[model samples]
Target: MTKRIRKAVFPVAGLGTRFLPATKSIPKEMLTIVDRPVLQHVVEEAREAGIEHFIFVTGRNKAVIEDHFDIAYELEETLQKRGKLKEYQALTEQLPPAGATSFTRQQAPLGLGHAVWCARELVGDEPFAVLLPDMVTMPAPAQRDRCLAQCIEAYATHGGNIIAVEETPWEEAHQYGIVSVGKDFGRSFEITGMVEKPPKGTAPSNLMISGRYILGPEIFRILEKGEKGAGGEIQLTDGMKTLSKHQPFHGVRFDGKTFDCGSKLGFLAANVAFALTNPEIAAPFKAELQKIFGTL
Candidate 1:
C-alpha cells in the first residue's frame, strides 16, 4: 500500500539577489502576487494537497513570514470593529491550526538540501513534500489539481520518490535539473537519472523538474550526511540522484501553468497573470492593459 503524504517542507532561505533592494528587508516569498503573497500561494497549494503540517525552513529577515502565518488579534479585532466580517475572518480563518505550522531557521546560506534537512526532525518518518515558494502554479477554478497535488496523488499510486516535471525546450533545459526516463508512462515515468543544468543540447531529456517533490523519509538520511556538491553547497538534486539509484523514483509531468517568481520578469508576469483572473480586478485590469498596449 502506498503511504499517505501529510507533511510539506518549504525552503525559503534564498537571498533573492535577483530582486535586490526590495528583497533586502522583505522575504522574497512575502512578495505579493495580486493580493496574496507568493509564500501563501504555495501554502494554500500544499493545504489543498492534503498536507497536514507546514514546515518552513527560513533564513535571516524571514521573521515576517512567520508572523504572517501567526494570528493577529489586534488586526482581526480592528477588522471586526469596522464591520468588515469577511476581512476579519480572512486573517483568522486562513491561519493553520496552531500546531499545524512550524518554522526553523537555516542559520547559514546552505543549499536546498541542507535547508530541507533542517526540517527532518519536524518531518519525522513520514513521506513528506518539499515545495519551493518560488515556483508558482496557477490552476483553473474548476481544476482540482495543483502542481504538488498531482505529485501527491502520483505517490499514492506509484509508491516511490515522486517529482513533478514538465517539458522544456532543450535550450532552457540547462536552467533546471533535467531528467532521464527509462520508460515513458505518459503522464508519469520511471526516472533513470537526473543531471543538474546539463550543457545545452546535451540534456538526456527535455523534461525538467518542477519545484514540487514527494520524497520518502530515507531522503532525510542522505541529506543528513550533508555532502558538499555543485558549488560546494549541499544540493538537493545530488541527494535525490543518490536516492534515485537505490529507490524506485518516478517523474510526473503534471498539467498547470508554472511561474518561476524568483526572477523579476517571471514575478511581474505572475502578478499580471494572476491579476487578469482576479474577479474584482479582471474587468478593469484587462481594459487598462489593452489600452496601454494599444498606445505602445
Candidate 2:
C-alpha cells in the first residue's frame, strides 16, 4: 500500500521582485487576495485536502508568513473584550493547531528544487505534496475538487508522482513547463516527458504544469544531484523529469481556475475574480465593475 500523504511543503522564499516596492518589505506570499493572504488561501486548501504537517520553506523577511499561522493571543483577547465574538472566532479558526506547522530556511535563492530539498529532513521518507503559494486555484461553481485534492486523488490511483496540469493556449505554452503524455486516462494521463519553457511552437503539448504537485520521497534523491536547468538554477522540472524515468508520473487536469498571483495582471484578475465570489460583496462589486466598464 502507498503511504498516506500527510505532509505538504510550501515554497515561499521568492523575493517577489515583480511586485516591488510593496514586496521590498513584505513577502509576496502575504499579498492579499480578496481579504486573505495568498499563502493562507493555499494552506486552507491543503487543510481541506487532509494535510497534517504544513512545512514552509522560507527566506529572510518571511517571518510574517510564519507569524500568520501562529496564534495571536493578544489579538484574540482584544476581540473577545470588544464583543467581536464572530471576528474572534474567524481569527482563531485560521490558526493551525500547535505543532502542525514547521518552517525551514532556504538560505539562498537557488531555485524551487533547492527549496523543496530544504524541507527534506522534515518530510522524511514518504509521499508529500508541494504547493506554490503564488498560484491560487478556485473551483468552479459546479466543480467540487480543490486542485491539490484532485492531485491527491490521482496519486492514490497512479501511485507515483502526480502533477496538477492545465491547458494553456498553444501560443503561450512556451512560457511554462509543458508535459507530454503517453496514455489518455480522462482527467489524468501518463506523463511521458516534461520540457521547461520549450521554444515557441516546439512544445509537445499545451498542458502546462501548474503550481501543485504530489511527489514521492524518491524525488529528494534526484534533487540532491543539484542539476541546473533553464534559468541556471535548480529547476524542479528537471528533477521531476529525471524522476519520471524511474517512477510512474501522471498529470491531472484539475477542475478549477488557476490564478498566477506572481504576475501583476494575474494578481489583479484574481482580486476581481475572488471578490466576485464573496456573497457579501459580489452583488455590489459586480455593479461597481459594470459601472466602471460602462464608462470605458
Candidate 3:
C-alpha cells in the first residue's frame, strides 16, 4: 500500500527583493492579499489537501510568519469582549496548534534546492509536497489538495515523482522549466525531460512547471549532491533532472488559476481577484473599484 502524503514544506526563505522597502523589514511571505498573508493561503491550500504536518523552511527576519500562525491571545480576548463571536472564531481558525507546525532556518540565500534541503530532518523519508509561498493558487474547493491528491494517486499507480505543470504561451514557455510531453493521461502527462529556461526559440514544449510539487523522498538523496545550476544557485530543476534518470517522472497540469505573487503586478492582481471572490468583501470592493476606475 502507498503511504498517504501527510507533510508539506513551504519554502519561505526568499528575500523578495522585487517588492523592496515593504519587504525590507517584513518577510515577503507576510505580505497580505485580501487581508490574509500569502503564506496563509499556501498553508490553507495544503490543509485542504489533507496535509497534517506543516514544515516551513525560513530565513532571517521571518519570525513574523511564525507569529502569524500562532494564537493571538490578546486579540482573541479583545474580540470576545466586543461580542464579535464570528470574527473571533474566524481568527482563531487560522491558528494552527504549536506542535503541528515546525520551522527550520535556511541559513543562506541559496536556491530552491538548498531551501528544501534545509527541511530534510522534518521531511525524513516520506513523500512530501513542496509549495512556494510566492505562488497563490486561487480558491478552488480542493485547490492544492486536488493537485496533491492527483499526484499521490499518480505516484501510487506509476511509482514516480510528480510536478505541477500549466500551459503557457509558447513564446513565454522558455521563461520556465519546460516539459517534454510523452503520452497524455488526461490531467497529467508522462514527462520525457525538462529543460530549464531554454532560449526563446529552443523550448521543448509549452507546459511550464508551476511552483507546486509532490516529490518522492529519493529527491533528498539527489539534492544532497545537487550542484549549483543556472544563476549559480542550487536549482531544484537540476536535482529533479538527476532524479528523473533514476526513476519515472510525471507532470500533472493543475486545474486552478495560479498567481505569481512574487511580483508587484501579480500581487496586486491577486488582491483584486481574492477581494472580488470574498462574499463579505466583494460588493463594497467592486463598488469602490468601479468608482476608482470610472467604468474603465
Candidate 4:
C-alpha cells in the first residue's frame, strides 16, 4: 500500500531581493497578494489538498511568518469586544489545529534543496509534498483544480514521485527547469529527464516543472549527498533526477494558471488577479480598473 502523504514542507527562506526595499524588512512570504499574505494563500492551498502537517523551513527575520499562523489572542479579543464577530472569526478561521505546524530554520541562503533537507527530521520517513511558495496556482473557474491537490490525486494512482508540470512557450522554456516527457498516461505522463534552465531552444520539451511536488522519503537520502548542479548550490532537480533512477518519476500537467510571485511583475499581477476574485472588492475593483484604463 502507498504511504499516505500527510506532511508538506514549504521553503520560505529566500531573501526576496527582487522585491527590494519593501522586502528589506518584510519576508517575501509575508507579502500580501490582495488581503491575505502570500504564504497564507499557499497554506490554504495545502490545506485544501488534505495536507495535515505544515512544516515551514524558515530563516532569519522570518518570525512574522510563524506568527501569522499562530493565535493572535489580543487582536481576537479586541475584535470580539468591538462587536466584530465576523472579524474575530476571520482571525481564528485560518489557524491550523494546534500542534499541526512546525518551523525549522534553514540557517543559510544555500538553495532550495538545502532548505527542504532542513525539514527532513520533521518530515520523518514518509512520502511528503513540497510546495514552492513563490508559485501561486489559480484553479480553473469551473473545475477549480488546486495545483497541489491535483498532484496528490495523481500520486494516489501512480505512487512513486510526482512533479507538477505545465507547458511554457518553447522560446521561454530555458528560463525554468524543463522536463523531457515519456509515455503518456492521459492525465499524467512519465518524466524521462529533467534539466534546470536548459540552453535556449535546446530544451528537451516545453513542459516546465511547476512548483508543486510529491516526493518519496528516499529523496532525502539522495539530497544528503549534497551534490551541486546548475547554480553551484545543491539542486533539488539533481536530487530528484537521482531518485528517479530508483523510483518512478511522473508529471501531472496542472489544470490551472500559476503566478510566480517572487518577481515584482508577478507579485503585482497576483494582487490584481486575486483582488478581482475577492467577493467584497471584485465588482468595484473591475470598475476601478476600467476607469483607470479608460483615461488611457
Candidate 5:
C-alpha cells in the first residue's frame, strides 16, 4: 500500500527583496493578505488536504514565523478574560498539536530545492506536500481543496509526483516553469516535460507551475544531486525534472485565484481583492476606489 502523505514542508527562507524596506524586519510570509498572514493561508490549505505534520524550512530573521504558529498564552488568556471567546477560538483554531509541527533552519540561501532538501531528515522516506507560503489562493471551498488535495490524490493514484498548474498567457508563459502535457485527466494532465523559464514563444505549453506541490520522497535524492538552474539558485524545477525521468509526473489545474504575494503588484492586488470580500470593509473600500477614480 502507498504510504499516505501526512507531512508537509514549507520553504519560508526567501529574502523578500521585492518587498524591501518593509521586509527588513518582517519575513514576507508574515505579511497579511487581508487579516491573516500569508503563511496562515498556506497552512489552512494544507490542513484541508489532510497534512498532519507541518515542517518549516526557515532562515535568518524568521523567528517570527515560528512564533506565529506557537501558542500565545497571554493573548489567549486576555481574550478569555474579556469574554472574546470567539476571537480566541479563531486564533487557536488552526493551531497544530505539539510535536505535529517541526522547524529546521536552511543555513544558506541556496534556493527552493535546497530549502526543501534541508527538511529531508524529518520527511524520512514519505511522500509530502511542499507549499510556498508566498503564494495565496482566495478562499473557495472546492477550488481551495482542489489545489492541495487534488495534488495529493494525483500523487497517490499516479504513484509519483504532482504539481499544481494554471493557464498563463502564451507570451508570458516563459516567465514560469511550463509543463508539457500529455493526456488530460479532467482537472489535471500528465506531465511529459517541464521547462523552467524558457525563452518567450519557445515554451512547451502555457500551463505554468503554481506554488503547490505533492512530491515523492525520491525527490530528496534528486535535489541532493541537483545543480542550480535558471538563476544561481538550486531550482526545485531542476530536481523535479530529474525525478520525472524515472517516475510519473502530473500537473493539476487548480481552480482558484492565485496571487503571487512574492511580488509587490501581486501583493497589493491580493490585499485589495481580499479586502473587497469583507462585509465591513467592502462598502468603504469600494467608495474610496470610486472617489479616487473619479478624481483621476
Candidate 6:
C-alpha cells in the first residue's frame, strides 16, 4: 500500500530581492493578495488536499509568518467584547491546531533544495509534499482540487517524486525548467527528464514544472550534499533528477490557472484576478477597471 501523505513542507525563505525596498522589512510570503497573505493561500490549498501537518521551512525575520497561523488572543478577545463574533471566528477558523504545525529555520539563503533540507528532521521518513508559496494557483469552483491537491492524488497512485506540470508555449520554454515527457497517462506523464531553462528550440517539450511537488524522503539525502547549480544555489531540480534515477519519477499536469506571485507584475495580476472574482469588490472593481481601461 502507498504510504499516506500527511505532512507538507513549505519553503518560504527567499529574501524577496526582486521587490526589494518593500520586502526590506516584510517577508515576501506575507505579502497580501486580495485580503490574506500569499502564504495563507498556499496553506489553505494544502489543507484542502488533506495535508494534516503543516511544516514551514522559514528563515530569519519571518516570525510574522509563524504568528499568522497562531491564535491571536488579544484580537480575539477584543472581537468578543465588541460582539464581533463573525470577525473572531474568521480569524481563528483556518488556523491549524497548535501541535499540527511546525516551523524550522533555513539558516542560509542557499537555495530551494537547501531550504527543503532544513525540515528533514521534522519530516522523518514519510512521503511529503512541497508547495512553493511563490506560485499561487486558483481553480474554478467546479474543479475538484487545486494544483497541489491534484499532485497529491498523483503521488497516492504513483508514489514517488510527482510534480505539477503545465504546458507553455514552445518558444517560452527557456524561461522555465522544462520536462521531457514519455508514456502519456492522460492526466499525467512519465517525466523522462528535466531541463533547467533549456535553450529555446533545444527544449525537449513545452511542459514546464509548476511549483507543487510530492517528494519521497530519499531526496533529502541528495540535497544534504549541498552542491550548487544554476545561480550557484543548491537546486531541488538537481536532487530530484538524482532521485529519479533510482525512484519512480512522474509529473501531473494540473488543471488550474497558476499565478506567479514572485514577480511584481505577477503579483499585481493575481490581485486583480482575485479581486475580480471577490464578491465584496467584484461589482465596483469591474466598473473601476473599465473606467481606467477606457481612459487608457
Model 4 alpha-carbon drift over 4 Å, by segment: none
Q: Which stretches of candidate 1 lie over 4 Å from their true place?
A: 140-142
Please name the candidate that would achieve the greatest lDDT relative to the true structure: 2
What lDDT does candidate 4 reach at residue 19? 87
Evaluated against the true structure, the overall lDDT of model 1 is: 0.90
Candidates in order have lDDT scores of 0.90, 0.94, 0.85, 0.92, 0.88, 0.90
The total number of steric clashes, by the backbone 3 Å criterion, in model 5 comes to 0
Q: Candidate 3 on 154-270: residue-level lDDT in tens?
A: 767766688888888997887888889999888777999988899989988898888888888888887778589888988899898888898888888787777889989989999
Write one digit per residue (lDDT tens) for candidate 5, span 134-172: 888774544436478777777777767889998888988
Off by over 4 Å in 6: none
lDDT of 6: 0.90
User: lDDT score, residue 93, model 1?
Assistant: 62
Q: How many residue pairs clash in each candidate at the backbone level?
A: 0, 0, 1, 0, 0, 0
lDDT score of residue 241 within candidate 6: 88
Over the stretch 1-296, how does candidate 6's per-residue lDDT look in tens digits? 78988999999888999989999999999999988999999999999999999999988899999899998889999999999998788888879976999999988889899999999999999889999999999886678789988887887778778989888888888999888888888998899898787777899988889899999899899999998988899999888988989987889888878888999998999999999989999999999999999999
In model 2, state the lDDT of residue 19.
99
Q: Which stretches of candidate 5 lie over 4 Å from their true place?
A: 139-146
Candidate closer to the true structure by lDDT (higher is better), 4 or 5: 4
lDDT (Cα, tens digit) per residue for candidate 2, span 105-186: 9999999999999999999999999999999999878988789999988888888999999999999999999999889999
- Candidate 2: where are CA atoms >4 Å away? none
Candidate 5, RMSD to the unseen true structure: 1.7
* Candidate 2 worst ten-residue window by lDDT: 137-146
Task: Give candidate 1's error at residue 250 in angstroms.
Answer: 0.8
In angstroms, the error of model 3 at 225 is 1.4
In terms of lDDT, the poorest run of 10 residues in model 1 is 86-95
